[model samples]
Target: MAGDVRAASMTARAFVEDYLLWTRGQRAPSRIAGASGDVRRELVALRLRPSRGTRRGRPQITELRTDLTSPTAGRATARVIDRVLGAQYTLRLDLARGTDGWEVTDVSA
Candidate 1:
């Protein structure tokens, strides 16, 4: 017997978490499905951060929120709560539902 037939999908926040993991090199690119070409390329271009004198490590997501505008559209914002490079920056994302699942359509600082 087979399991549930429904296609498993991730929430907007979960997708963002995966994206952040990819950015930190904690997860592989293949782990993130339904991302746009540009998003994929950007992730590929990211390099690991070099350790500074501080004992602290990589940046971590402090807080995040997602607004599901519709069944097909979602907007999300993530903030780095930990101390690290670009920690002050906030990631804003626009997502849309594709044939496969929800994929990021746009990203802004």
Candidate 2:
């Protein structure tokens, strides 16, 4: 049970990291799940498409903390520092377990 919680936490953390990277144009959008339409549109609107010789390095996940309230629901917070942009950002995530696994139900920064 403890291990399951840990795995869910890790999964949520990785999901947030990958989603952020996608928003910043450093990652592709193939593997992510449970993203809202508005979020995707916003990312697309940013026009931050990655290109060769881009100025910013990939963003790094600094600190990720997860709270598993139950087997079905949890929350997480993460700190990401963008080396290229020279900025630090926080991500707050809400997760819910499903038949497939953990899914991000909501996220904010």
Candidate 3:
């Protein structure tokens, strides 16, 4: 169970990192490979798409934390604190265990 939680945490962290990069145009959407359709839609709804004209630089991930209320429940939440252009933002991501691994199901800021 500990290992499962750790894996889920890692997955959540990686997803956040990749998603931030994608937002900055530093990475492609494919970088967020394990995200669910709902997660993608949430990004669109949040207007967190990549920059269009000038490519933005990478954001720094200052803090990342994951919470698994129930290891066996196959669901987890990740909170990420990132710094971009000297401003900080908090993002919350919900994840669920899938057949291929953990997939991000939702996102909010």
Candidate 4:
């Protein structure tokens, strides 16, 4: 039970980090690997947006916190604070554990 929660948290953290990178264009769309469902479609739609210029550099993940809302149901949510060119952005992510492992189901800013 505890192990499951830890795993889910880790999965969510990794996904959030990848998502931040993807948004900054440091990572390719195909590389946002832990996303699925609506979140995946959102990423596809965002492909047309221009990536951030290299002058700004990559975004830094300043803080990340994950809460397991339902361990038995394999559901979790994460709050992330990231810095981009000195600006901070807060994002919320919903995750679910499927047969393959944990995957991000939705994201909101």
Ranked by lDDT, top first: 2, 4, 3, 1
Per-residue CA lDDT of model 1 for 1-109, tens digit only, reads 0111111124445656676666555666566665677777776676545334322445566767766677777777778654655346687888776677767776677
Candidate 1 ranges with C-alpha deviation above 4 Å: 1-10, 45-58
Give per-residue CA lDDT, model 2, range 1-109, as digits (tens): 7876787777777788678667656675554555444455555566676665343567778898888888788888989888666789999988777787777777788
Whole-model lDDT for model 2 versus the true structure?
0.73
Q: How many backbone clashes does candidate 3 have?
A: 0
Which candidate achieves the best lDDT against the true structure? 2
The order by descending TM-score is 4, 2, 3, 1
lDDT of 3 at 105: 80
lDDT for each of the candidates? 0.61, 0.73, 0.66, 0.68
lDDT string, candidate 3, 26-100, tens digits: 655545766787776655565555555434465666666666656433444444444345556777777777687
TM-score of each: 0.60, 0.73, 0.72, 0.76
- Residue pairs with colliding backbones in model 1 are none
**After superposition on all CA atoms, how large is the RMSD of candidate 3?**
3.3
- In model 1, the worst 10-residue window by lDDT is 1-10
Off by over 4 Å in 2: 33-55
Model 2, residue 79: distance off in Å is 0.8
Model 4 lDDT tens row, 38-100: 777778777655444632555665666666677534444444443444566777777777898
